[model samples]
Target: MPEHHSGRARRIPPTLAAGLISLLAVLALLVTLPGTATAGGVKRPVHPDRDWMGVTIRAHEDGAGPSAAAQLTASVEGVDVSSHNGSVSWSSLWNSGVRFAYAKATEGTSYTNPYFTQQYNGSYDRGMIRGAYHFALPDNSSGTSQANYFADHGGGWSRDGRTLPGVLDMEYNPYGDTCYDMSASELVRWIGDFVDQYRYRTGRDAVIYTSTTWWKKCTGNNGGFGSVNPLWIPRYSSSAGELPYGWDFHTIWQYTDSGPTVGDHNRFNGSLSRLQALANG
Candidate 1:
């Protein structure tokens, strides 16, 4: 694996790195609490049994403890993780107010997250609405090939009303070639190819994940993909800023990379029921 592949959560400019460090300590504590309980009757795990990166991700969500004040701002709060999170305690996350999760599945058609099975299965076993995502590397491979690989590995969708459509994470290129060295039209074409393959395989559109700057530069504010894929916008600051060309509203907003108790906090822009509808697709 290339040393630059640090997963989707850390894909950000160096200038903003210092500002985000303060939140890392707090965010890593999401599943590191010695003892605590959430407001909705979910408690911490008593005997943790999950493992990642040599860490034990135990759960204690007994649904019987003094509830702590919920700090999640959105109607639906969740986390997206890769190997960086290391042995996640899925049940504890649900007990701690995480309603959904998007785990890193495959990247550039060849790289599949080693923890994909554990994270995906753990979230589902714990009753959290779970989905898988693929990291786009347009510079390295065809989008269709990557999409097919993603589905075959872990990004496949179901009508179980709990699996969210797969996400196409095409943002700041982690491996040097930002925009994947593609022209505006070529970038749009690559994304279209990805969306088509994902839709054909899953019978649902893939959510498009990208930052405003990347979208502007690569797609030239292209709205061609608006009808097929909903936008999953990422902004680290307090505000979401301007969105891409097509959508008047975003389906999902990645509000922050570091949460008070987790990494990469995300919000579904609708009520819980509405979120379930999207999941049910």
Candidate 2:
């Protein structure tokens, strides 16, 4: 079973990863579904998982901006290795129009995503822009120890030419019976400690990943670490709309689980010049 820790919950253990792979096998057996018309009149499949979220091509019609499909670069919205294939095989994703990726790094002291190095290095070698994430540790005896463990693992970005930033996964550990023991302020402080130490060593601003529920319960509108770091908000739904709160402008918008990809296993994702700006910063 996958171990659950406060700052260590986001990553999928080897056993869990193996289970997901097997789950996909079962999912493949489901009957194929057809596409439906979206609000924009764009026809999209009801269940995109069946087709690997194939890329959509649109022309510059009705006086819209230049056609994105013609440009050959598409926006990518994706999760870490828990959802997509291992990092090294992401070349198919790049070719299929995936614009960005986030790979799992470390969680607390005991667990590190086994695929982190393979995926991070592999994505870089294939010229795919990618980021790294550290699961937020809860405020307890293991908090700082987990932060040190992440620092030791190098978190994701190297001091090389890579541009994307590291991410701090801040969702609460649902499995812990006492997970709600910490007050909101305490949670903010714990997250801040992780970000501060990570930035000190990596020389890059670590981004924050959280949903509205987790942000409200833990951060309590404190905006942990302030506006100095970027935010990667995850809001999945049919609409691909704006974030709930008037939060800082997100660097990456994880808009959908349904996306285009290069191979049968990879996922599509999106981002703007935000990544370039971070790289130059």
lDDT of 1 at 248: 81
For model 1, what is the error of residue 5's alpha carbon versus the real structure, in angstroms, after optimal superposition?
Answer: 55
In the range 48-98, model 1's lDDT, one tens digit per residue, is: 212111021012111122222233364688788886676788777887788
- Candidate 2's TM-score: 0.62
TM-score to true structure, per model? 0.73, 0.62
List runs of model 2 lying over 4 Å from the truth. 1-79, 83-88, 139-143, 177-180, 224-226, 238-246, 258-273
Best by lDDT: 1
> What RMSD, rounded to one decimal, does every model reach?
18.7, 17.6
lDDT of each: 0.72, 0.53
Each model's total of backbone clashes: 8, 13
Residue 61, model 1: Cα distance from true site in angstroms: 37
Model 2 alpha-carbon miss at residue 190, Å: 0.5
Stretches of candidate 1 exceeding 4 Å from the true structure: 1-74
lDDT of 2 at 56: 14
